[model samples]
Target: MNDKKEIRNILLLVFVIIIVGALIIAKFYGNNQKERYNISVIAGEAHAERWVVLQQGLEKAGNDYNAQINFYTVVNGKDAREQKDLINRELEKKVDAIIVCAVDSQEIQEVLQKSERRTPVILIETDLKPGHLYSQVSPDNYEMGYHLGEEFVRQQEGKETTAGILIDNDKIAAQQERLKGFEEALASAKNITIKWRASDYQSNERVDNIIGMDCVGTQNATEISKVNNEKISIYGFGNAEANIYYMDKGIIKALVVPNDFNMGYLSVQNAVQAVEKDMVYKNTIVEYIVVTGDTLHNEENQRIIFPLVQ
Candidate 1:
């Protein structure tokens, strides 16, 4: 009888140990299974028209991907030294990765090299010089330009039409690609001539000057078939969506739309994914809309695409 009691006590002790061990293992597994990442976005400016929608999209992406986004704004992207210093500060934070909308395409490479030494970078809403950057998530600027170019060809079927670009006039990825795509799309058309000289290259002053240039189309409803600036069709890039609503009651035939909110949100989410998985994205092209008369009139349409935010 004494031996049997001792055996029963030992069995109870073993059962308790097994249950305790299973509980500990379950706790550790649950903690490790959850994935999280940290990300940063370097926006050119806080008040930029496009930045608003980009912010909304970024928020949406964050909710979807389970990540966090932090934004760093510069007074102006053109100030290279200041921009570099800003990047250095972000690097110190040891973010998993960074997303950039560079102010100057040329000088940004230096910043990229410095940050990339410690973490990966994803370029968003713009392009980067091709060698070492992680990935680019942006709208197809050139394709959007091509769509605009096609608008000129269709409208002027038989008439001679001229087109111009309002751009920064730099080697920036977005600017160069857009200019290239616009020209290619219009390459075969003889009646439509793209202005060899871009009258208003990208400058804050130039962007500010376009009160009613009809960068896309003659937005005035006064005359449905004719343009106010009949001879010239202008293409504005940044915050181009504003032209949709701001112009008098008419439709602009061609404009480029950026999915800013999505870009903002995805940039953060992708950076987090890169950190958690130790991986990076390649050739991730965000969506861009080619707005013509049919699409631009609806404010809701504009909101759905890029959400005229700034």
Candidate 2:
């Protein structure tokens, strides 16, 4: 009778151990099947060449981070308003986080705030004016602008004494910063003087505005050069088209190139990182590349780029 009782107790202990072990295995399996997080990236427009490189980088990041990332693109040449509306729709989808390449920084900020009212937002490529919200994921365009200023001074070291600024429109932040930075650098150079103009008009009008003056509008550099045959140096975003125009016409002496390819790549990389677990991102700034004589000589070397047509 004693032996039988002991055997029964051993059997009960084994049964209890098996039950607990099975429960632990089941819990581990359940947790492994759960999703981590979903990330969304909004490109202001679909047509720009730079966004193409950015999108690839974004996808790669998603794959590496083990997160679900959807890139939403709108029609090219659409208004910033449309991009904002589309962003709102994505926000409603309840993504874990968002990354935006704003069409118009100021206009886009208004939309970002609404989305952030629900989740964290990271602004990439472009940034809102001070005080709007979120971390900036781009370079110091203003500083790039100042660098433009200093670059002009260095370029004109022993040459002409008169120069000017061509801004794209009063609207773009990068153009404005380039203009400002260029002027500040020229300020200390006694040999050169700068003028400011808008690129809204044609070559004839541009020449009329700055024929005797140095021109600096971040817009239509290629066209602006055709108008201003005077010995003028341009300080604005570099475009391959514009470079060819200037090279053929002998108009632009130097230009500030925005590495759009890299910007696109970095912006998307940031979006991917922000959405991933145990990942982090530091905002990037617009870096400067100077394109001059030999470098801008050939189409192959020029960097005003768009994605390949599929």
Candidate 3:
């Protein structure tokens, strides 16, 4: 009876030792696991289809990298104060990284200054003065515009052509740069002249009468083209769903489509890397595709105009 009791006690003691060892191993493993990162994306406009697609890409990257994303947008993308408020809110949230398309580069300066030391800030689609942020992910706006101008010159076929230009009034640096590049490239062709320039498409009286019109944004381009029933050749930026619909109907002659999907995906990926991996993030320039109705059916252009996800 004594021997049996001693044996039972020894067995119980071994079992307790095994249980304690298992708990310690589990705790160590849990502690060593990587923490998921949180990235925030602040776009100029939330409702626009382009930004919507960008959000899709951001989400995709978040999923791919095991990170979470908080996306914010201004009610009116052109309103600097609205964007500034959103930035401040994100800063308070203590996000790991911030990606923004600034409404007004200068207006966001002070807000960015507040985030400089705490978070990794990245610029997308639009650029600002570079000191406060980590890096920028955007297309070469000048190159995109220059390509559109080249297309315009080709369409004119050396005849004197009067073109109307509708520029965004929001003072987005990218838009202004696009307009500048287009103007400079078109100037080289003496046969093409910009006869009218206006911030509002409706305000440009010659929109319908001109040989062609260079629009800076997709919304205005689609609107003017539809309202005029394709009366003039329309060339512009953006690859929104409506823009694609208009292009299919032969309303928009050409579109300078940026790789917005890649922009979003890369921005998030880089942001997460910047935080967790101690990786160096730099300016990433996504390329643009000039899609026309003729080339829209092509496989590569189709991917740009009608993305699979967004």
In terms of lDDT, the best-performing candidate is: 3
Q: Write the per-residue lDDT of candidate 3 for residues 217-249, one digit (tens) a residue.
A: 656756776677667767787877777787788
lDDT of each: 0.59, 0.55, 0.75
Model 1 scores worst on lDDT over the 10 consecutive residues at 205-214
Greater-TM-score candidate between 2 and 3? 3
Give the per-residue Cα lDDT of candidate 1 at 163. 47
Error of 3 at 89 (Å): 1.2
Q: Which is the leading candidate under TM-score?
A: 3
Backbone collision tally, model 3: 0
Q: Kindly give the stretch of ten consecutive residues in candidate 2 with the minimal lDDT sum.
A: 207-216
By lDDT rank, best first, the candidates go: 3, 1, 2
Q: How far does residue 164 in candidate 1 sit from its true spot (Å)?
A: 3.2
All candidates' TM-scores?
A: 0.72, 0.63, 0.88
Candidate 1, residues 128-150: lDDT per residue as tens digits? 64545466777777776677566
Clashes of 2: 22
Residue-level lDDT of model 2, residues 207-283, one tens digit each, is 21221111223334445445554444444444445443664454555555565555545554555555453335465
Residue 142 miss distance in model 2 (angstroms): 1.7
Candidate 2 stretches greater than 4 Å from native: 1-39, 44-46, 66-78, 129-133, 161-164, 190-195, 203-219, 224-235, 238-255, 258-262, 276-288, 294-310
